[model samples]
Target: MATFLYRIGRWAFRRRRLVGGLWLGVLVLAVAAAALAPSGEEADLAMPGTESQRAFDLLDERFPQSNSQGAEARLVFRAPDGRRVTAGENRATVADVLGSLEGSDQVASATDPYTTGAVSEDGTIAYSTITYTADAVDLSESAKAALQDAASRARSAGLTVEIGGSALDAEEELGGTTEIIGVAVAAVVLILALGSLVAAGLSLLTAFVGVAIAFGLVSALAVPLGLTSTVAILALMLGLAVGIDYALFITSRYRDERARGSEPEEAAGRAVGTAGSAVVFAGATVVIALVGLGVVGIPELTKMGMGGAGAVALAVLVALTLVPALFGFFGRRVLSRTARKGMRPGGAARSRGREAELPGRDAGRAGLGARWARFVLRRPVAVLMVAGLGLGAVALPALGLELGLPGDESKSVETTQRRAYDLLSQGFGPGFNGPLTVVVDTSESGDTRATTDLVVKTVKGVDGIASVGEPVLNRTEDTAVLTAVPRTAPNSGETKDLVHAMRSALSGVSSGTGAGILVTGTTALNIDISEAMSDALIPYLSVVIGLAVLLLTVVFRSVLVPVKAALGFLLSVGAAFGVLVAVFQWGWAADLIGIEQTGPVMSLMPILIIGIVFGLAMDYEVFLLTRMREAYVHGASPGEAIVSGFRHSGRVVAAAAIIMVSVFAGFIGMNSPTIQTMGVGLAAAVAFDAFLVRMAIAPAVLALLGHRAWWLPRILNRVLPDVDIEGESLSRHDPASSAPSQTSAAEPAPVRQLPVGRD
Candidate 1:
């Protein structure tokens, strides 16, 4: 693998113009396709095989006028303290608002509160229903503006008005100041780490190009593929992050090679051969975890996983080809002035001698990583215990984690939807915001009315039932639908229990009446989705963990190292979940992060964290450990190898982790609760995994294991294909590639054999 990559990298560097033009041409074609493709529609949020989804499909087939398929808004109006909404003047204002809403071409119908008996017992609060002709995403902006205008007029007429519904939901505004800030932070980090503005800019440039191409292709295919905006955003986020990091790794390696006296083309080849091998394996781990989302059987998640995988793959390709080609153009300019000076004439010999000195000792110039590695090596048990205890403490809160879908109740208090939700809760009850629709199909029953009555009676008798509305039958009188309000909030655990209890209670009615009965609503659908996510979590974890262990075993050619890496990943993910539950569920320091409301964590958050964090965790594990294995194979002691690996790769790994965290954290500023939760969760996962697990626990474990850390059973080693992830084969295949100038007579002899079973 390393030999092949080396050849490709050297070829690309030699023919820079052709390689650069190829990528540029691909980008242009992607842009043109995106521009010519038609706009994509939102994917259906349906959970097939669930009772709620079946009920929805049945409603659409049998009762088209039910307006269940269209978006609807509830305009809640509250009169002044001493006035009632039914007062002559207040009634006129309400009538005028309804009239204006009905006049809009987008509005299918608008009902008056008086005629619909939607007024509160005190008559001070009332709500009118406005149904739109199109779905929420299809609704025109002008229609929303008209609704807002009508509400504003009512407010001026001494009535407090607020509108709440799916029609008001707009696509989350992405690629603005938040993303720019993240990119800016990443740029600064790169510049500081590389110590060259040109190097930093080159990394960012390649990453941006990869992201643009990936996003363009996603956009072009979204319509036909049923991809959502969220998928595109996810693709952009992962692409930019991994692209920059991959390029940075290769570029940093190239500089190291040049400092050791390798020629420009040779340095590029070695860099790509060694570092690019790690990048490909790391990216494969990510892609494996992402593509494994298909096992969850959710269409949206599958699309998102595939989209993100595509972006990461593109980043890897760009790093292997474009990065080397760019290096050819920059040559020594890719390094800082001081670095370039250090590589001049006889300077490379002096630098190489200095680097080849005692592995763990660099006199007074030893780096922080070197010092930390020595400390861990001296007291591996203590370091492991401290890290373990700290991460365990952080993970304790995960035991109390609850999952649910975010609704208006989870929105900021300042949003009109939230305000309307609160007002409705105050006037009616908390359950009014989340009414469950009971759909009864009685086509097989001789007495439809009797079957419908039995369903309503059974539902009303449920423990959590607050009220059951009168059953309204279809024109054929074979199907009846009713609304059943619960006594708890939409996202509350009690409401979920209520839904389950109602289903259990209605099963008997269905059996006796020979009718189909389903409980469904926005709230019920969300509950079903949450349950589906929870059920899939175990299977998803199994698949990804198995993949992680298998992939790491092949990459490192060790049994214990893969096991240790997988366990460390679990710790990081658990800690991330704890942080999520602490802030989003327990409201611990929620205000500090701008969380206006707190409830259950988003249903999809846990699965997302596990899949994404597993990939990223493997990234640090592979990059850091491969270098350690390289040092070990090159005749360094286990302890010395740990120090040597940190000395070479620690700063780059740290920079990459920080860049990824920043990109994810930037999404915290988004107004969407789901996005905000994802941001905090992913950011926390990366931080814990990178700084604590990889830096401390991983090295400590390796130190404790000593020579046994790299052990692989002879039988399994024979079965597993040798990937040569450390580019060890490159040194053997081309003796000149291993610079003799970089080694000193005092240093230990290099081990020529494969390092699979060092013990």
Candidate 2:
């Protein structure tokens, strides 16, 4: 494997221009294809096999008149002077607004509040409902513009008007300033690490270009795959972080090679062959974890997982191919002139002079990183217990974790959706924003009215019931629909409990009346989605974690090592979820980050976070352990190898963690609460994984385990494939090698089955 990758690296170096041109061509093609592809629509987090889906289907089939198939847009109208909206002039203005909305080609039906009694009891506020022919995510640009134009006309009048719901959400533009902030921070970290502006720029450019290609591809896939627009944003976020980190790993190795006086081509080739292999492994782990998100069986989550996986895969390819090719093309110019000169034997004095001027230049290899590793080793037991307990403590809050979809309350209060929600809650009740639709089937007995009355009576007796509207009989008069509004807010735990209680209570009525009863609507659907995701979480975790352990076992040729890695990753992810629960659910100091409201974390956040964080945690594991494995294969003692691995790979992991955190933090600047919540969760996960799991607990555990850390069963080792992730064979074959192998010629062949003791 090492030989194969080395040859590819050499070939790329020899034909650098062609490789560079090929990538550029692919980039252009990607852009054009993406631009020409149809835009994708967002899929609701609806589970087809669930009770909520059954209820929705029954309603759509048996009682179409009860509600539109598509989503509804609410238009809230308030008199400017706090006058009653029912006043003659105010009513006239509202009528004109509804008239304009009714005339819109986008609207399937527009309800008049004056006749429907959709006005507030105080008469100061009223809202009309517009049901579109398609869902907001499926609406065309022309339709959206028309809706906007109608709203503008309403605002032109003396009435205060706001249009809300899925329509406005569909039109919301997530900002890029957060990404820019992330990039800016990444660049500064790169410059500090590389000590060369050109090198830092190369890393950033490589990452940016890779992410651009991924964004284009994700956009292009949207139409064909029915992906949400948020997929592109997520792809961009993952792409930027992984792309830069992959490039940094390769670039850092190349710089190290150049410093060792290797020629540019040799350095690029060796770097690509060695660190590039690790990048491939790390990136593949990320891709696998992301793609595994599909197991949850939610279409939106599947698309997001696929999009993120695709972006990371492309970034890995670019890191392995284009980055090295560029290094070949630029040669010594890739490094700063001062750094390049310092590599010369005669320029030792000049290098010393330059080192005095550069802050981190001399401290790169033997700084606090090495000292920290040594410090941990001195008290491995103490370090292991303390770090483990600390992480467990941090993760304790997750025990009380509550899962639900974020509602209008989580949105910016300034948004039209929030305004509409507030007005409705004020006018009717909090439950008005999320009505429960009960679908009754009486085709057998043909006693729809009797069943409806029974169902309504049963629902009214439920604990959380605020009100039950009159039943709307279907055209066949064999089925009826009832709307039940609960006192609790849509996303509240009480609402979900009430939904379950209502269903249980109605079961008796359905059996007695010989009719089918189903609870459906936004509130019921959200609860169903949450339950589905929660049920899938354990299985999803098992798959991703199980796959990770198998892959790490193969790569590291160890049983205990993989076990430790998986457990550590779980700890990191748990801590991240704990933080998420605290900040988003409990609103613990949420105001520090400018958050004004708190709510339940998104339903699928746990699965998404587990998949993402598990992969990333393994990235550091692979990079660090591969170095230790390499050292062990070359005859270093287990203790020496652990310390050496830390010294060698710690710096890169630190830099990569910083970059990832900054990138994720950028999404906090987005207007969407979903995005912001995800940003914080991912950022916290990376920080915990890097600082606690990898830096502290991993080394401590390994030190305590001694050589047993790399032990693998002989039977399993024989079946597993031999994967060379560090290019050890290349090092052996090279005749001009400046660093001699530490392995004795009498030593056994380097393979998965190594003795559990020093040679």
Clash counts per candidate, in order, are 0, 0
lDDT of 2 at 222: 78
* Model 2 TM-score, 2 decimals: 0.91
- Model 1 poorest 10 in a row by lDDT: 356-365
lDDT value, residue 485 of candidate 1:
91
lDDT of 1 by residue, 1-759 (tens): 898999989999999999999999999999999999866766556778899999999998789876555777889999999889999999999999888887695898988899889999888899999998888777888988899999999999989999997778777788777778888999999988887899999999999999999999999998899888888888988898899999999998887766655678877898899999999988988888888887777778889889999999999999999999999887767886667655557433134441432121222223877888999999999999999999999999999988888888988898999999999999888999999999999998779988888888888889988899999988999889999999888988899999999999888888887898999998999899899998998888888888889998888888899899889988999999999999998999888777888888988889977887888898899888888988888778999999988988888899999999988887887887877888899999999999999999999999999888888887787899989998877765332334354355333356834445523
**Which one is best on TM-score?**
1
Q: What is the C-alpha lDDT of each candidate?
A: 0.86, 0.80
Residue 741 of model 2 has an lDDT of: 30
Q: lDDT, candidate 1, residue 449?
A: 87
